[model samples]
Target chain A: MTATTDQTATAATSAKLSPYKRFTPTRGNFELWSWVFMRASGILLLVLVFGHLFVNLMLGEGIHAIDFAFVAGKWSSPFWQVWDMLMLWLGMLHGFNGVRTIINDYTEREGTRWVLKTLLVVATVFTIVLGTLVIFTFDPCIDPNSTLSVCTK
Target chain B: MTATATQPSSDEQKAGAVPTFTVTLKVQRYNPEVDEAPHFETYEVTAHATDRVLDALHQIKWEQDGSLTFRRSCAHGVCGSDAMRINGKNRLACKTLIKDVNPDKPITVEPIKGLPLEKDLVVDMEPFFDAYREIQPFLITNGHEPTRERIQSQADRDRFDDTTKCILCAACTTSCPVFWNDGQYFGPAAIVNAHRFIFDSRDDGGSQRLEILNDKEGVWRCRTTFNCTDACPRGIQVTKAIQEVKRALLTSRF
Candidate 1:
């Protein structure tokens, strides 16, 4: 028999011979999903990432246009605000899941894994909270008495 | 009479011709309740040409002693169990054959370093999972459901695809020297996971996750030993992911 057939036969025989089995991973399926995800996300990333670059670099006065005032200008508009918000959320999730895979593959200690992942979640949350705050609560033109330049603007 | 006797002896020797080879296995054994200190136990097992170290362990457990214990879920190398220090290197016990480790000399097997040993070859895994969950490894969109399916191109998914293969085995994390001393350091595996979505186009939490990782124990703690990469069973390019995150942090105007 061919190798494929031989493997099939062996599997069949093993199944017949043994009734109690514990935690046999359904191989090939997880990998298949991961492969599909890479292609799909990679394409979306090209658009979102490149669009971000183009707008920041080529739009209006281009790279020279960027400054504290420029950022204030973009955040002021709801359209740009939504666009940036989407970029931040998507990029972090994708990267986080990807690294999760890396962690599962490498770390052997159960305690260590738990500790490290917990830290990752805490940090991720802290950043998201702080960043969203900065994005939303941003004050471009502040009172003249304020110490910050952006606030002074 | 002498010739007859010699011939008979030679025939008997030939009839019981089983080549006996001796292999010494030095294993580290620890029991907190029973033993005051951890000690090494050596076993000499006579194995065949096709015997693996796992097989030797079985022989030792079965014939020599029964107190020896280690974690083994799948005899095959899939479930991420059986990872241990084999001859001073991190590898799965079931995947490494005896001949490959040391053909003539004794082979040493110990629990992975940088963790508290619960018993023989079993380390506490709570800390490792803590770091994993800390990264918030989930989709956190603005709760705005798309009218249709969230459309993403093939290339967008491909950017973080290689990184998603991690199995959370802790081989990479324990292998890290930084984690050994600085428990607060996020370690390589957590950073790699954070980088996965941080760079993804579909996900939106980049700046948020980046800010979290930018802390003292975050991505900056990575010394780039490449031990996490080398020890990973899945062949993940861990160092590259860390570098990518570092680049993202540097270039972002925010």
Candidate 2:
């Protein structure tokens, strides 16, 4: 419903719109990739997290059977290890991206937002690194020398 | 032409009297045929404290330069045609009084952000209206049409009453940073219009709108910046409406 008021025959409007009071969006396909990652990882996380909960809380002796040995029992197998690792990586990445969106929306000052995002990256990297190391290098048997229990003979 | 006898002649007028002062307006000027880039041109207009920003532009066009072009109609906020950037904020000029802003300094007026600026204070609204059209923002009833008027309760009408007031001014959409960065995002105005139809009890298009909004560029694109809500002349909770559409998509419920 815009009114065509005071039309000038010679003058024309600009086809370009320069940024005003807005931060330049992430360079390249960062946002597009980030958007794709959210949807993809979200669907994967739903299955992984629910399946994990079902195993830990609904299968066998349910929640009561969960202990250090129970965790050791699961991590002993490469299949379970990979499952947990996938879950760990996907969950953290999804959560980190979601929080990053929140920070961008809420933080008015550019400096504060940059700092918060930097912190998010650091924390996510540290957690993923530490989690992956634990899953792959975990010792099922408490004693390294022992050939008993879940240890290899 | 007769000069106004009651108009204040000086800035020394008291608060109760018409306090006339000089307002420097820096308007963004662009002529595609002549200039390669947009530039600012300054104009000084005498205005009373009660005078709206539209009056200042009118003065500049009528007295200073007849070629100073812009869009305005009804001289009131109802038509939603005079929306422009008033000192960096998207606001209807007719609704903004000179005194409300810091008129002591020069005021910068530009066309709203995120749209292709066609001329001073005008943008090609085709893209914006295209998004609005894509959503199919109309009541849809799949079942047999009722011979009588379809009845709706008060609660149903009140649920979507806020979004219904949107005048499609493009204020909320242009104010959004996401819309600015990527034009593909459905923008807040489209989502808001869909919300109006989706929540209406008489409308059968809730599921259809929800499905359309479930795409990657739909409601999920809204990061809750609240800029759209701030820019909305009708005071619609734009971000909140986007959230509602998101919830509807997730739950598959209206």
**Top candidate by lDDT:** 2
lDDT of 1 by residue, A16-109 (tens): 4432221333222243344345556777777888998999999889999998777887898888777777677666656765676556545756
Model 1 iRMS: 17.0
Quote the positional error of residue A125 for candidate 1 in Å. Answer: 38
- Give the winner by TM-score: 2
Highest-DockQ candidate? 2
Interface RMSD of 2: 8.7
Instruction: Give candidates' CA RMSD values in order.
Output: 17.9, 9.9
Task: State the lDDT of candidate 1 residue by residue for B1-254, as single tens digits.
Answer: 44334443543445434333579999999986699878999889987556777888889889988889888887677777778888888887887878788759889999988766778888866567666777777776767889997888899889988788876667888888767763556777788788888877878888888776765456755667898889887788998898788768767733
Q: Which 10-residue window of candidate 2 chain A scores lowest in summed lDDT?
A: A14-23
C-alpha lDDT of residue A34 in model 1: 48
lDDT of each: 0.74, 0.82
- i-RMSD of all predictions: 17.0, 8.7
Every candidate's DockQ is 0.02, 0.07
> What is the per-residue lDDT of model 2 for residues B99-170, given as tens digits with 9 covering 90 to 100?
887899999999988787777777878678877997898889888999999988898899999999998888
Candidate 2 lDDT:
0.82
